[model samples]
Structures are given as C-alpha cells and as structure tokens.
Target chain A: MTEDELGGRLAATAEAAVQRLAAALGAAPLAGETARPARLLAAMRHGVLGGGKRLRPALVVETARLFGRDIDDGHGDILLAAAALECVHCYSLVHDDLPAMDDDDIRRGQPTVHRAFDEATAILAGDALLTLAFDLLADPAGEPDAAIRIRLVTRLARAAGMGGMVGGQMLDLAAEGRFDAPAAPMGEAEVRSLQAMKTGALLRFAVDAGAMLGRASGADAAWLARYGDLVGLAFQLADDLLDATADAATVGKATGKDAGRGKATLVALHGVEAARRRLDDLVAEAEAVLQPFGERADALVAIARFIAARPS
Target chain B: MTEDELGGRLAATAEAAVQRLAAALGAAPLAGETARPARLLAAMRHGVLGGGKRLRPALVVETARLFGRDIDDGHGDILLAAAALECVHCYSLVHDDLPAMDDDDIRRGQPTVHRAFDEATAILAGDALLTLAFDLLADPAGEPDAAIRIRLVTRLARAAGMGGMVGGQMLDLAAEGRFDAPAAPMGEAEVRSLQAMKTGALLRFAVDAGAMLGRASGADAAWLARYGDLVGLAFQLADDLLDATADAATVGKATGKDAGRGKATLVALHGVEAARRRLDDLVAEAEAVLQPFGERADALVAIARFIAARPS
Candidate 1:
C-alpha cells in the first residue's frame, strides 16, 4: 500500500479506538454502587477521552488485522484489547502527571485530572483506570478462550507493573538523583535499559498482544515479537527526537526538558543527527523483518515509517 | 469447634498470609526487565510485608478450607489467591496514606511508604502491588482451569475498581467536603453506602474469591456471597467502633480521627452502644447463612465473631 492508499487508514483506526473508548467510559457499569455518572467516573473519562494520537490501539488493531483477525464485526475482540491497553497508557499518564511526579499542569492542552478534580480524585481515578484495564481483559465477551485471555492478562500485568513501566519510572527518578545526591551520570546502556522498561515494554505489548490474540504461534509469533521490539525502540527514539526539535505547541506538551534536567537519553548522549540516523536504521530493520509476510504487513510497515518520520 | 480448640488458628492463618506475601514480593518476577530486586521492589515489600493482620487473606484461605481446600501442600493455589487479595489491600493502604490523600505519617506503627521512601517510589510501589494482584490470579498454576482463573480476575477487578473501592473512596472524600461545599448531611443509609464501597467491597471479594476458587458453585456460592456481605458489614462496623473507643497504640494507627474529620459512619450516626448492637446483628446474620455447612463452617463463624470483637 502506498502512502496515499494508507491515508486516513491510520486516522480511521485511531477514531475507532476513540469511539470504543468513549463508549466504554461513558457507559461504564460501576458508579461505586450507584447508577449515575459519579465524579470518579467523570474524572476517569476526562483523563482518558479527548486528545492524543491513539497510536497504541492502532498498533493492536493493525497487527491483529495483519494476522487475518476480523474486526468488522464490532471490531471483534481486538477493540477491547486495544482499549484495555490504552487504559494502561492513560493511567500511567494520569499518575505521572501528579504533583508528586512530573507535576505537569496540562495534558493534551487541557487541565490535568488532579487540577480539574482534586489530587485524591486523580489518584483514585488512575487506580480505577488501571483496575479497569484488567476488568476489560477479563470480560467474557472479549477473548473466546479463557486460557488466551489469562495469558493476555498476565502479559499486560507484567508490562504495566514491576520490571516494566512502574519500575522504569522509578529508575528514571533515580537517574534524576531523586534518592541520591547527584547520582552518577548514566551512560547509554543504562539509559536504554531504563527506556525499555519505561515505555518500550508497553509499546512492545501492543504488538505482542495483537499477535497473541490472533493466535499467531511459533515462528509467526516470534517474528511479530521481534517487530514489536524494533518498533518500540523506534517510537521512543522518534519521541526523543521530537522533544529535541519540536516546540511545546507542536508536541502538545513541554519540550526540551531532557537537556534541561540533564537527564541522559540517547538523544542527549548522541546528537540529534545521530539519533535520526539510528531511527532510520531501526525503521529499515523493522521493515526488513516483515518481508516474509508480504503485503499483509503493509499497514505495520507504514506505521514503522510513520514513527520514524513523526510530526517534527 | 470451641474457642479453645480454635486457639491460635486465626493467628496461624495471619502468619501464613504474611509469609506467602513476603515470598511473592521478595521473589517478584519483574524488577522491570532486571533479575535483581530494585528500589520499586523494596518499597513494595515495605508496604506489604511489615504489618497488618492479613485478615483478607485469612478470609480467603479459611473460606476455601471450609470447602475442603488444602493448605498442607504449600497452602495450595488458594494461598496465591489469598496473596493476590492482600496485594490489593496493601496497595489501597499505601495510596491512602499519601500526603495528598489521608496525609498519614505512619501505617502499622511505622512510617508510611511515602515517609519511608519518597512519594514517587511509594506511588510506583503501590501500582506494582496492584498489578501483581492480577498477575497472581492469572498465573497458569493458580487455578487448574483457565476459565476459572479469568472469572477470579474479573471478580477482583470489579471489587477493587470503580463502583467499588475506588468509587467509594471518592464518595468519602466528597463527603468530607473536598469537592463540594457541605455536600449535604449524610444519613445512615448514605454512610452505609459509603462504608460498603470503601471497605465492604474488598471484604466481600475475599470470601467470593475463595468460594469461586474452590469451585463452590450454585447454592454454595450464593450462600458464601451472602455470608461475605454480612461479614463485610460486621468488619466495618467493628472498625468504626474501634475508632470511636480504642486508642491509637492498640490499633497501630490513628484512632478517633474519623469523627474528628466529621466523616460519618454508622458509629457516628448512632452512638457507640447502637454500633455494637449492629455489629452483633451482622455477625449473627453472617453465621446464620453458613448454617448449611454445619461444623465445617465453625472457623468462618469464629472469624465473624472475631471481627465484631476487634482490638477492643
């Protein structure tokens, strides 16, 4: 598929995710034993709905689609998986934005959840969103097989929990010398390990979950997993590049904070030009692996190219 | 069984939960892509291992044992379920003690996770602990049937998520006039609803998970759920009574603050004498529901009685 052919397809997938997420949040079953849309639910909806690229869900759906999973029928079970993954992503943001964490006042150009609703509510909302992700996964309507569903639950829990995003966040803070006085400057390897846990794991799961849900086993699964790893690295590299070059307005959040905080990212260790070249290499390696799958993986390849050449 | 016969069984149950929880957190699978334990893991251990009666896990193991579940073989998978539920319980306490939430300086006679570590680490530890709950439930070895495991996951998510514990917490905050001015005076029913969500839900899940995990379907499951509901009410009422009458040292945390904050409880709505009566009634109802099981349920009945007569 050409760029023109893939036009609006990504956006369309994003839109589908947004719609499903909105429906899920809007009609959420629990109001803490009440039937009305309580303040907690409203805060959750606020944290989740509105903006962002919906990139994670796109990875899930597009990868599932590549494996011949039918999403035409109410998006099959893929949308639920997609939405559940997005919940983890969004919950991370909500917690990360707390006054105690990143202390950001705005997300997607709107007031953060804590700012809109108080700190306690934001904390509870983040907790609820995280719990909701598991709830969605365990829903009987999602995966056809209980065993597969449990596997998905375990993968997501690992990715979002210890050794994954939360653990990565702690490492990131430690690198910032939060616990020690002027912690030793981190090198590239440490930075890569940190990044792999902080963001790479979830992005990896996006593709891994899709392939697994589609029952792509053995070599087919191994190849997809490889593709996920490359894409995860490429996506984060591009994000760092955007942070280096793009304005806060363009990226829809603060920019250039890495250098400001003296944090060691690959971009900080190596120049922006080197990061760009590395990104190119990543995209090439990512695309090369999909050659075995022919045009069925065109969407996945397009997503890889898109990641390498983001909004900047 | 006589109280003399029951002897240290409750203490033994509590001890079992603590040991299992220690192993789970000590040997946590993900230190975020690292094989060694990380700061996040340490903080999680700090939050979960050092304190509390492990009542939730006891409720799980005892209930399952009543249905012939075994512990002689390393506590069986019921211990995993027990450990998993305790994680949720621990996570809530960690988050609740945050400066932005309850501003608690200590938990179980020691500094809270935030005071012991930094706020960020405490938050991350709590997140990991919560995620670990599902990880335990979804573990292939936890339950023989994948279908049964998924059901356990779903039930836990609901009990802990919105319209349950988190939602109940929001209501409690709102009742404190955090979001709205005065928020109208809460009556007995309103207080009951708030208490149910804030504490009752998880207490309910403890027995519900045990019964389901033990394959006690049909009428057996229904009776256990009813018993869970009554026990949940009894536990909270007893807690409220303690807050009203006991000193901080006995409970290992602040007491009388519930009324100081003007937080309404059944104990506050009706005087201490009335609350005690209510506790008695709840325990009776709880034990009555288990009449079908006869002597096998003596442990459960004793537990309900113990809940009504906490540290007081």
Candidate 2:
C-alpha cells in the first residue's frame, strides 16, 4: 500500500479504538458499585479524551487479528484489550510530562495534564489510568477465559511495573546528568538496554499480550514477541531520529530533548545515517518474523514500516 | 484483655508482617524476568520498609485467621497479599507527599521519598510499588487458582484504582479548596463519602480480601465486608482525631495537616467529642458483625477496638 493509504488505515484503527475506550471510561462505574465522581472523571477524560496516535492500541488490535480473526470479529474484546494498553501508554506520558520528570508542557499538540489541570490532578489521573488498565484487562465481559485474563494482567503488570518501564525510567533519569553529581557517560549497550526497557517493554507487551489473548502457542508466541522486539527497536530509533531532526510542531511534542538533557540514544551515539540504516534493517527483520503467517500479517508489516517511515 | 496486652498483641502481629514484607521486597524479581535496578529497588525499599503501624496487614492476617488459617498457616500467601496492600498504601503516601500534593517532607519519622530521594525517584517508586502490588496478586506460585487470582486482581485494582483510593484523593483535593476557585464547603455526607473511598476502601479490601483468600462464602463474606466497613470508618475517624489533636512527634509525621490544608474530615465536621462517640459506635458495630464467627474472631474484635483506641 502507499504510505498515505497505510497512514490512513492506521489512523482509522486508532480512531475506532479511542471511541470505544472513551465510551468505556465514560460509563465505567466506580468501585464497580457506583458512578465515578464527576470532577475526577472529567480530569480522567481530559487526559485520555485528548487525541493522540493510539499506536499501542492499534498494535494490540492488529496483533490480535493475526490469530485468525479480523477487526470486525471480536471487536469488543480486541478494542477493550487495546484500550487497556492505551491507558498505560497515556498514563506514562502524563507522568513523564510532570514537572518532576521531563517537565514538558505540551503533548499531542495540547497542554499536558498537569498544565491543563494541576499537578495533583495530573498525578491522580496517571495513577487512575494505570489502575484502570489492569481493571480493564481482568474485565470478565471482554474475555471469558479466566486463565487468559490472569496471564494478560500478569504480563501488563510486569511490563508497566518497576522491573520494566518504571525501572527504565530510573535508569534514564540517572543517565541525564544531575547537578550535584553527573551520571557517568553511557555506552551504546546501556542506551539500548534503557530504551528496551523504558519504551520497548510495553510495545513488546502489546504483541505478547495479543499472543496470550489469541492463545498463540509456544512457537507462534515466540515469533510475535520477536517481531515485537524488532519493531520496538525500530520505533525507538525512529523516535530518536525525530528527536534529533524534527521540530516540536512536527513531532507534536518537544524534540531535541535527549540532546538537551544529555540523554544518550542510538541515534545520538551513531549519527543519523547509521541510525536510519539500523532502523531499516530492524524493520526488515520485523517483517521477516511475520513470514510464517504469510498474507495474514500484512497489517503488522505495514505497521513496522510505518514506524520506520513516519516523519515525526 | 487489658488494653496494654491488646496493644502488645497488635504490635507483635504488625512487626512480624513488616519483617516478612521487607524480605519479600528485597527478594522480589521484577516481572519474574529480570532484576530491578539497584537504585530503584532501594527507593522502593525506602518507601515500603520505612516503619508504620501496618494496621492493614494486621487486618488481613487477623481476618484470615478467623476463616481457619492462622498467620503461621499459608503464611507466604497471606504475607504476600498483605504486602501487596501495604505497597499500595505506601505508594499513595509517597505520591500524596509530593510538592504538587500534600508536600510533606517527613513521614513515619523519616524523610519522605521525595525529600529522601528526589521527585523523580519518589514518583517512580510510587509507580513501581503500585505495579508490584498487582504483580504480587497475580503470582501463580502464591494463588494457584487462575480464577481467584483474576478476582484478586480485579478487586484490588478496583479498591486502589480510580473509583476507590484515587477517586477519594481527588475529592480530598477538591475539598481542600481549589486554587482558582475554592470548593464549596463539604457537608457531613460529602466528607463521609470522601473518607470511605480514600481510606475505607482499601481497609475494607484488606478484610474482604482475607475472606476471599480463606474462601469465605455467602453470609460469612458479607459479615466480613460489613465488619471491614465499620472498622475502616472507625480507623479513619480515629486518625482524623489524632490529626486534629496529636503532635508531630507523637504522630510520627506532621499533624494538623487536615486543618492546614483545609481538607475536610469527620472530626472537622463534628468536633472531637462527637467523632469519638461515632468511633465507639463503629467499633461496636464492627464487633457485632463478627458475632456468628464466635471466639474464632477474637483477634478481629481486638482489632476493632484497637482501631478506635490507638493514640497515633
């Protein structure tokens, strides 16, 4: 497909997923017993209802489709799973943008949660979003198999939890030189590992979780995970390139942040030419991993290429 | 039993639970796939291992004992669950103390996480602890039943998530009066709901979760839940009184924070005398709910009274 067509398809999928998620959040009862407080709900809606790419949710939906289902089939179940992942992604962004963290003021062309509302509300919104992610995963209405639900929760928790994204964040902060004692200059391996955990882990979970939900057995699950890892690496490389090259307006958020903060990235370590070369190879590897599924993996292949090719 | 003897028993239970929890935190592998970063783990340990009453863990242990399993039996399972709940509690405290929130510098007589570490570390620590709580819940080694594990995840997520603790926090902030436009003063019912969700929800979960672990059923589970609600109220009312009346040294943290923040509380609405009287009634109701369990519930009865009587 042409790149524009591919972009259109991805946008369409993300739009549909966001609609379902918005509805779910709007109707979600507090404590599963009563209506959520209106003000709190508004804060949550402010954080989530504001538009973004919804790439994580699209990944989930597309990955689930690989196991002999289409977007039209099991739409509710697939969208719910996608929405849960999206919640985690959005929560991470909210927390990352806090004055204590990256301190960014804008996201997806809108004011950050802490900026639009307040820091306290931003923190709670992130907390609630993260909590709601798991709640949505364990939701019986979407998936009836208790075992699968448990596994999904376990994987998502691991990916989002201390050992994964949160741990990576700590490492990232340390890498950004502090005033009192600057961080030791990091090598390529360290940067790769940090990115793997901080950004790649959840992306990996998106596909791995899809495999679990699809009941992909040992071999099939392994292939998806491999694909996920390669795509994750490629996505980050592209992001690094964007940060190195794109403007804040094109990226829809701050760019040149890594270099400004003295944070290392593969692109920073190996120049833009090398980074682009590696990203292309990673995309090819990602596509090859889907060879076993043949034509059924077309959407995912498109997604991998899109990750590498997106301008911002 | 004499009040002093009762205090001794509660202290002993809390101490044991804390030790087990500390050990578990030390040994926990992130995501069961990798070691957590040393610095991040230290931050998490700091937040969790810092001393507190451990009343929630005690509640879990004591309530489970009523259903036929003592702390010594299924000790790993019980401690893990209690630790999970405590993690959530500690995480909330860490976040609540952020400069953007309550802005406290000390907790449990030590520097708060942000003060001890930094805002980034504190924020990440809270996120990690919250994530670890769910990780502990879905632990296959502890609760082998997938159905039960999923249920545990669902219940805990609900209690800790938007509708419960997080939602309550938002209400608490609103009650504290908005910076741009102060909130209308909360009435008694508003204050009650805020307290119920903020503190009571998790306390209720501690007992209700114990019943889940013990496989309590029908009327047994209902009684435990009702008992939990009463004790949760009693615990909060007592806490409000202590906040209004205690000193920082006695409370092990800042007191008079409620009044300072303009945060509404039961004691704030109804003077200390009325609040104390209601607490007594709550304790009585909590004990009365345990009547059918007979002497098997002695520890729980003691717990109810302790909730009303603790000085700090």
Candidate 3:
C-alpha cells in the first residue's frame, strides 16, 4: 500500500475505534455500577479519547478482519474488542506519563492526564480505563461467545499484568537505577527481553487476541502469533529511533528522552542504520508469515509496514 | 458463634488465603509472561503479602462453603478465587496509599507500599496485583468452566472498575476539592452512595462471587447477594466509626482523619450512638438474609457482626 493509502486506512480504523470507545464510556452506567462519577468519567475520556495513532486497536481490528469464522455477532463487535485493547494501551500511557513515572507533560499534542487533571485523577482514570478493558471484552455485546470472552480476558490479563507490561516497566525502572542501586547495564539480550515484556507482549497479544476472536486453526494462530512477535519488536525499535531523531512536535510528545533516562534499546546499541535494516527485515518476515492467508492479508501487511515505519 | 470462635475462624481463613496467594505469586511465571522482573515481583509481594484482615477473601470462602455445588476442580480452587478478590482489595489499598491519593504511610502496622517502595514501584505493584486477580481466576486451575470464568470477569470488572471502586475513589477526591473547585457538600445519601461505590461494591462482589462459584440457584443467589450488600454497608459504616473513635496505633493506620479530610460519612452525620445502632440493625438484616442457609451461615453471620463491631 502507498503511504497515503496506509495513512487513510489507519485513520479510518482509529476513528471507528474512537466512536465505539465513546459509546462504551457513555453516560449510561453498565450493570452493577451504582453511578458514574462525572469527574472520573471526564478524566477517563481525557486519558483515552485524547488523540493518538491508535495503532494497537488497528492491529486488532485488521487482524480479526483478515481471519475467518464470523464469530462476532455484529461488525461493531470487532470494533468493541479493538477499543478494549486501546483502553489498555491508553491507560498505560496515562500511568506511564505520571510525574512519578515518565513525568511527560504532553502526550499526543495534549497535556498528560496528570497535567490536565490532577495526579490523583490521572491515577484513578488509568485504573478505571484498565478495568474497562476487561469490562468491554466480557460485556455481552463485546463478543458473542463466553469462551472467547474468557480467553480474551486471560490473554489480556497476561499481556497487561505483572508478568507482561507492568513487569517490563519495573525492569525498565531498575535499569535506570534506584536510589541505592547503580544503573544496571543491560546487554543486547537483556534489553531485548525487557522490551519484549514491556512493549512486545501487548502488541503480540493484540494480534493473538484477534486470532482467538476469529477462531483461527491452531497452525494459523501460531503463525499469526509469530508475526505479532516480529511486529512488536519492530514497533519498539522504530519508537526508539523516533525518540532519537524526531523533534517533540513531530512525534506529538516529548522526544529525545531515552538517552537522558539511560534507557537501553537495540537501536542505541546497533546504530540508526542497523535499526533501519532490522525494521525492513521485520516487515518482510511479518508479510511472509501472512503469505498463507493469500491476498486477504494485504491490510495487515500494510499495517505491519506502517508500524515499523510509524513516524515516516 | 462467640467472639473467640469468630476470630479463630477468620484468622484461619486468612492464613489459607495468604498461602494460596503466595503460591500464586511464586517465582514461576504464569503463561504469556516473559519473566517476572525481580524488583517488580518483590514490590508486588510487599503490597499483597504485607498483611491485613483478609476479610474480603474470608467472605468469599464462607459464602461458597455455605452453598452446594461441586464446580471447583480442586478444593484449592475456592481459595484461589478468594485470593483473587483479595488481590483487587489489596491493589486498591496500594494505589490509595500513594502520596497523591490518600497519602497513607501505614497499613496493617506496616509501612504502606509506597512508603516501602518508591512511588513508581508502588503504582506498578498495584497495577500488577490488579492484573493478577483476573489471571488467577481465568487460569485453567482457577476454574474449570469458561462460562463461570467469564461471569466472574464481568462481575469483577464492574465491581472494581470505573463504575464501582475506581469511580468511588474519584468521587472521594472530588469531594475533597480540586485546585479549581471548592469541596462539595455531601449529605448522608450522597455519602452512602459514594461509600457504596468506593468500598461496598468489592465486598458485595466477594459474597456474590462465592455464590457464583457454587452455582447457587437464582433465588439463593439473590438472598446471598442481599446479605453481601448489607455486609458491605455495615463494613464501611464500622470503618467510618473506627476512623472517628480509634487512635492510629489501634487502627494500624492513620485514624480520625476523615473529619479533617472533609470525608462525609453517615457516622459523622448520625453520631457514634446512632451509627452503632445502625450497625446493629445492619447485622440483624444481614443475618436475616442468610436465614435460608440455616446454621450453615452461622460463620458468615458472626463475621458480619464482627465487621460492624470491629476493633472492639
């Protein structure tokens, strides 16, 4: 796909996901909710509805669209699932930007949740958004099958929880050094492992969750998972490169902080040229994994390239 | 049940829940985890394994024991489920203790998670603990039935998410006043509403979840749910009373700060004598709701009264 076409496709998918998400967080309380606190709802909307690329949800939507079985009760069901993933992604951003964490003042051309609201609201908003991920997935309208809903919950909990994204974050902090501990020098292998858990896990699960929704055969699902793994690594590599090369305006957030923070990445280890080559190879491998799906996988192939070269 | 017998039962159940939780958070990584980051694992262990009454899990276990259905794959299954609820409860405490939130330095006579760990680690630890709740429930051994697991996830997402506990927290903060807004006056009804969402929801979910685990008949589930609601209300009311009457050492945390914090509670509205009378009524109503379970619910009854008259 051409750059413009890919951008258009991504934008369309993001718009759809946003609309679905707005409805999910609408005024009507879900069952068991006594009442929705207005301030909290506004903060949640601020954290989630604020503009971003929405790449994660697009991956989920595109992957599910590429696969078969028609398990979703409605077309919107897939979008709801995609939106759920975005909730997790957005919540991570909110918490990650807290003054106690990354301390970023801006995200996606807007003030970080803690900056826009208060620290407490940002924290609670992130918590609620994380909870909503499971809420959206397990809600009856989100999916038709109980088995699939539970599987999604399990997969998501693993990807986003202690063992996955959260654990990775802790490792990242440790590498940056604590008050008593000196910075830990991570070799390429250690850096890769840390990044895999921090960023790669959720991206991989996004694609894997889409496969579960589509009920793909075991072989097909396995291949898709492998493809997701490559895509995840490439996505992070590009992000590191973007941080190094792009200005804050271009990236729509603070840039050039990785070096200052002493964050270790392969891009930093191998130089920009090597990282560029790796991205190309990842896109190629990702496309190859989808070869068996034939021309039906074109959108996913485009998305893989897009993620690998996001800023461009 | 005498006070001594009740205390023994609660302590014994707390022991079992703690053991199950330790096993759940052991060194072995569950599925989809790359590896448990050592520092993160320690922080999570601190937040969770640092003790409390374990009352929420006790409610789950006792309620499940009261019903009849052999759905759990292993006897430990119920304990696992109970531990899951405790994870949610403990996670809330961790986040709530953050400097930006409640700013609590002590819990259960130990330094709160944030006091022991850094702010970022405490935040991540709470996030991980919350994620583990779903992980333990959906794990193959957590429950054998996908349908039941999905139900639990949905129920939990509601009880713990924006519409429930998180929402309540937001409301609590809003009432405390933001930089731009003055503290909003909350009457008894509003206070009850806020407390129900903030604290009561999860407690109610504990008993309802136990009923779910045992696959109680709809009528039985309804009655059990009613008991949970009363218990939840009574539990919060007693907590407010404790905050008003107890010293920091006795409560094992900061106490008598609710009034200073401008936290609106019925205990504040009705005074101690009236609040005590209400607690008595709440316990009576709770026991009546469990009447259908006959002597099988004696332990739960005693537990409810204990909660209402805790710190005696």
Best of the candidates, DockQ: 3
| Comparing 1 and 2 on lDDT, the stronger one | 1
Interface RMSD of 1: 2.8
Arranged by TM-score with the best first, the candidates are 3, 1, 2
* Least well predicted 10-residue stretch by lDDT in candidate 1 chain A: A28-37
lDDT of 3 by residue, B41-85 (tens): 888889889878999888888888886533243643777778888
lDDT of 3 at A179: 38
So what's the TM-score on candidate 2?
A: 0.93
Residue B221's C-alpha lDDT in candidate 2? Answer: 88
Off by over 4 Å in 3: A69-76, A246-262, B69-76, B246-261
lDDT of 3 by residue, A1-312 (tens): 677887897899899889988998885886789889887888899999988888888788778877653324464377777888899889999999999998999988889988888899999999999988888888777667888888888889989988899989888888877535777667899899889999999999889978887777899889999999998888888887886576445673333455555667887799878998988999999999999998878878988887876764
In the range B8-100, model 2's lDDT, one tens digit per residue, is: 877887777677667766775655244477777788888998888888988887787777766657433676778789999999999999999
Per lDDT, the best of the predicted structures is 3
lDDT of 2 by residue, A1-312 (tens): 566776787898888778867886777575433336677677778788798777788788778778865455743376777888888888888999999899999988989989988899899999998888888888886666888888888788888877788888888888886424677768998888888889888999999877776778899999999999998899889988887776445673343556566687887788889998999899889988999999888888988998888877
- TM per candidate, chain B: 0.90, 0.90, 0.92
